[model samples]
Target: MWKIGNIYFIAAVAVIGGALFGFDISSMSAIISTQPYLCQFNQRGHDENGLCLGPTDDVQGGITAAMPGGSWLGALVSGIVSDAFGRKTSIQLGAIIWIIGSVVVCASVNIPMLAIGRVINGFSVGICSAQVPVYISEISPPSKRGRLIGFQQWAITWGILIMFFICYGSSFIPGTAAFRLPWGLQAVPAVLLFLGLVFLPESPRWLAKKDRWEQAVEVLTLIHGKGDPNSPWVIRELSEIREVVEFERANADVSYFELFTPGMINRTQVGVFTQIWSQLTGMNVMMYYITYVFTMAGLSEPGTNAVLLPSGIQFVINVVMTVPALLWMDRWGRRPTLLVGAFLMCFWLCINAGLFAVYGRAPYPGEFTSTAESMAVEGPPAKAIIAATYLFVASFAPTWGPVSWTYPPELFPLRLRGKAVALCTSANWAFNFALAYFVPAAFANITWRVYLIFATFCAAMFLHVFFMFPETANKPLEEIEEMFDDTKPGAIKYIGTPAWKTKNTRNLALRQERNETLSSEEKMGVSGEHKESAA
Candidate 1:
């Protein structure tokens, strides 16, 4: 049977998994303020103006958070499933789960049912989010690996932009269909992903680990050699993979406990913290609840296009800004991109917070606790806050957004790659669940102070990236392991080490020299065999 062997096509298909994540993000953000959504899910009844109100800030937060809660559990188990079944099958299972979860969410009749459905959907997202990057990284060539893995983030932004518009359009429908329509449509990308997986190749590294050497070489040849099994590039890559796999099989037992040994712990910390700080950047708060941020910025009319339209622009910016990362992350490298992004994100958040503090006030006079109260910051300062929010998204979309997904999966050894990435991705979902649940109440009581907290987080992450994270661009997966094999006990060991330098390309030169020697030997052997046959 014919299957896709082209790297770019495979990446496009795999990243639909990331798009499923995008769909869930804006699925609620776009429709949460519509009357159909509030009337059906908000148990607190209507206000004096006949508009519906939520039962409380906590209830609403829970409804928003239910998916990520399920996602955290899903991420935890994804490693086990991917390791046992292979990367392609694991993603296919996630797509199936997402379709079922979408049905439950679309048909939900109450808050509990709604939350239950979101959790199920979250579980599917968890599996996809954890494994998709691993699958892509394994299949991609080192020189283009960052860009290909970056396609996952670009897909996510496209998913957000597309789903937000879908929900925005549905909001005009007069009843439960407003929310139900978009929820039902969430299954479309999952359906496409599952079907697409039918024609995609499994991870070559997974094949190598399973001792399917012939199949692994075939896949590597197809992906990197354009069908030439004897191509020098293919031979070198296969040789490198076999060497690492054999060494790992002889030296180590694969287990979750392996992630924390003294030698492995630094790589593990870098992997896990890369994800944790991505969430700590508080970008999802923008994706998941842009409506609330706009409301606080004085675009307070909940169900109107005015509020929804501004958010659509933010989503567009997210999609557009991500393109540069996909094109240039290898050139820019991971460490500097992350450092610059963290500082810029901190700057934008501080600007937003300051604007709100100076010019904003609470809409209700007494103690604030629910969506019933709105922030009364208006006029030019409100516009500035909105502008700053846009700038924040711009900084994040290009830098941390794609790098977060690309960095972790490439950090660990082949034996530990799946589980290590799963743990790292779970950290992301864990924080995602917390912020999704907490932000509504934060908006009600603390208001602009939330931005200040995230700004501080960004500042801390800037230092973290500078001091701890090493450069990992333009090097083969096997070569990346060398950066973390230090005898020193702490990350400070990387401060002036060879691994810290962004321009390190010594490994590439060594690999090229090895490939040349092997090619010359092959030519000589073929000539000698012809002479023997003639004799």
Candidate 2:
């Protein structure tokens, strides 16, 4: 049967799972302020002009957060599913779930129905987001692994950009169909992803772990050797993978409890916190609720194109900026990208917070709290906040954006890769759920102070990455374990030995020596057979 043999094509097709997540993001962001969505789902009833007042702060947050809440549960179970079934199968399952959720969301008539649909969609996102990177990392060559995994983030940005425009177009339609059209369309990419997976290869490392040696070699040959099973690079990779898998099989059982053991605890911390810090950077707050942020900037009334168009620009910026990371993350290295990203994000968030604190007006005593009136700041100050937001996203798109997804999956062995990444992704969604729920209320009550909170988070994340994250760029998955093992306990243990300081030459030399030994044995066997025949 024909299957996708090209690695880049495989990465591109698989990241449609990430796009499903993007679709969910804009599905809410584009329509949350629309009259049809507000009137249909809001329990609060209509205002003086008969425009829907929308749900109260708490209800709206729940509505927005429902998907990530579902995703949190979905991520936890995704490890089990992927481990038992396979990466490609798990992603196909997620695509099917997303289709079902899109149907529910399109048909939603009330807050509960809407939340339920969003939760279902979140479950699908949870499964895909955790596993896509793992699959990509496993199949990719170590030299290009960062670039390939970075595609997941790039795909996410594309999903966000595409869906936001779709929602923007649908918003002009009459009644609930405005929101319903885009919500229903969410299944389109999920459908594409399902069909696309039929032609993609399973992860080679995953096959090796299952002891299906021939199939594993075939996959590695397809990906790395142009179909030459005897290629030196393929032989070296297979050797490294088999060595690690055999050792792991002899020594360890796959267990969640094992992740917390002393030998693994540092990796667990780095993996889990890498995701936690990604969320706490407050980038998603922009993705999930950009309209709200712009509304406070007094761009226009909540549902107007004035607000939507500018918010759309951020999506474009997100997509455009991610290209740099895709092109050069392997060269730039992960640790530096993360550290610089955090620092710049801190700088941008502080500027945004300062603008709001200085120029924004508090809500008038009788003004409706849910509308832009509650925290309006117009003219130059509002514009500066918008600029700061764009800069903040620019800071994030190339740096933490891709690195966060790429870093964690590289930290574990084949035995722990699936579950370990799921644990980390769940941390991402847990905070995603909290912030999605909290930010609306925070905006309503605390105003500019919210930006300050995230700014502080970015600062702390900078410190965390500097101390805890070693560069995982340009290192083979089987060899990354050595970096952790080599760390000695002391004041500088947190910094560890940098990944760049370790040379790939050592592994290359070892593989060369092994190849020479194998060749000598083959020649000796041939000579002995000839001697026996002559005798």
Candidate 3:
């Protein structure tokens, strides 16, 4: 494997956990709405005749929310698990957990059984969500780091898109198999992930940090330079790993409290709140309850197929937009992406709120209410609302979705990286849980007014990124520490500069670009010579 190619293969396989996480997202939402699921568990209860037994809003919220609650605890503990067992093993653990969860959900006989299953599966997702990006970030070369980690977010969206279509197909299934078959199929990816890990190598940097220098050098040779131990690039990268490890070993006793001190608070705030704003972008609101939102937007057809239009639009647009976003990520500064996304998200939400207010009257079905109560708008206004939602998803998928996946692992120093990322990931799930639980009530009570609250948060987040979050594009992990150092009160002048323009990041990016060009030229020259020799 020459030039990090092996790293890409491993990352792609490892992020299967992310795909399962994404599969669970749309699948559960799709299931809870079906007549079989509702009739069986909706708490409205079946008479001897088994009629009028649709699930209550509370049951809907519970089934939808169970995973996030488990995810929060899973994320909170993932760092410790990774640190104790290494990144590869943590991934394996998650896969095993995923298999168990899928079994429970698919076999469920009641709401409690299904909810318990969701929570278990959520635990698997929580661990993978935090650990996968960390693993990818640790293994990736700085020049290609953003793109590699972006794969995890891409895999997640891919899973969601595929699952939505699967849900579409499953809608034709009669009885409980519509949901059960999809839940069972979700386990396939987890099994693949577990089997794949048996052959892959651990993170070279983690091996170095644990004082296994020989193994680290061996992996570095293979991934960085096709197994040439004497290769200059291999030697240089290995040396950097050793140096980083030594530096971290000297300051290795990191505590959670230390993250809040004056010298570290800015980094802490940036890492923690990036996750917060991502959820606040209202992306999950749509993701978790797109069926409800679509119904309110006046989309309907017979069976679960009513979801086909909105779900298809979401899947295609997200999968397509995300590819280019990853390409632009390292070249364009991270701060600009956040700021732009926040503004556009705010704009779209405002438009949605305005359209709903003008086109539809009150008795608006709140967030918690059924679509029957909320589907008041018709014709053009209804279509406009649907368009607004797609726009919102468009703004979000490219910006917050992938950026949130990459930024946290880049924010902390080596000594505290694991804990910080784990904590930050937990924050993401915590907010996810809050919205998953409360959005129903929010929609039911305030209706269109709900968008106003999220829109305001988007405005605040944009300003925060402009003044508070320093740009981190193209900087090496060590250079990131220098950027945070300048965040102290007396050094605030450096905060707003584009990371690409900062002295360290600029020099590094230029060097990386030059090397890449030379590499391309050399390969082309060799190709030309080979053609001459063959002829």
Ranking by lDDT: 1, 2, 3
Instruction: Estimate, for each residue in 225-266, the C-alpha lDDT of model 1 and write its tens digit.
Output: 666677777788889888889888988899999999988988
Clashes of each: 0, 0, 7
Encode model 3's per-residue lDDT on 1-535: one tens digit a residue.
2233487788889888789878987786666556666656756664344443466666677778889888888988888888877888888999999899999999988888988998999999889998888888877777777788888888988898888778778868887887888989999999999988777777777787778888888776677655457655666677766766676677547677878988778888889999989988888878878777776766753234565556568877877878877787777667878888999999999998888788865443232236323435678988888888888988988788888888889888766777788889889988988888877777767788888999999999998887777766677676676567653234334445654344325457768656754665576578789999999
* Candidate 2 lDDT by residue in tens digits, 1-535: 6887899999999999998888888778888877777778767776665667788878888988999998998999999999998999999999999999999989988888888998999999999999999999999887778888999999999989999999888888888889989898889999999999999989988988888889899998888766667666688889989888887888889999999988899899999999999999999988988887887787755335567889999999999999999998877778888888999999999998888889988755433437433576879898898999999999999999999999999999899999999999999999999999999878877788898999999999988887767766777777686666544222223235653353333345445546644665666577779999999
Candidate 3 global lDDT: 0.78
TM-score of 1: 0.93
Question: Which model scores highest in lDDT?
Answer: 1
The candidate, 1 or 3, that scores higher on TM-score is: 1
Candidate 2 has which clashing residue pairs, if any? Answer: none
Ranking by TM-score: 1, 2, 3
Which is the better candidate, 2 or 3, if ranked by TM-score?
2
Instruction: After the best TM-score superposition of candidate 1, give how far the Cα of residue 133 lies from its true spot, in angstroms.
Output: 0.5
Q: How many backbone overlaps does candidate 2 show?
A: 0
Model 3 pairs in collision: 42-55, 366-443, 366-444, 367-443, 367-444, 368-440, 368-444
Candidate scoring better on TM-score of 1 and 2: 1
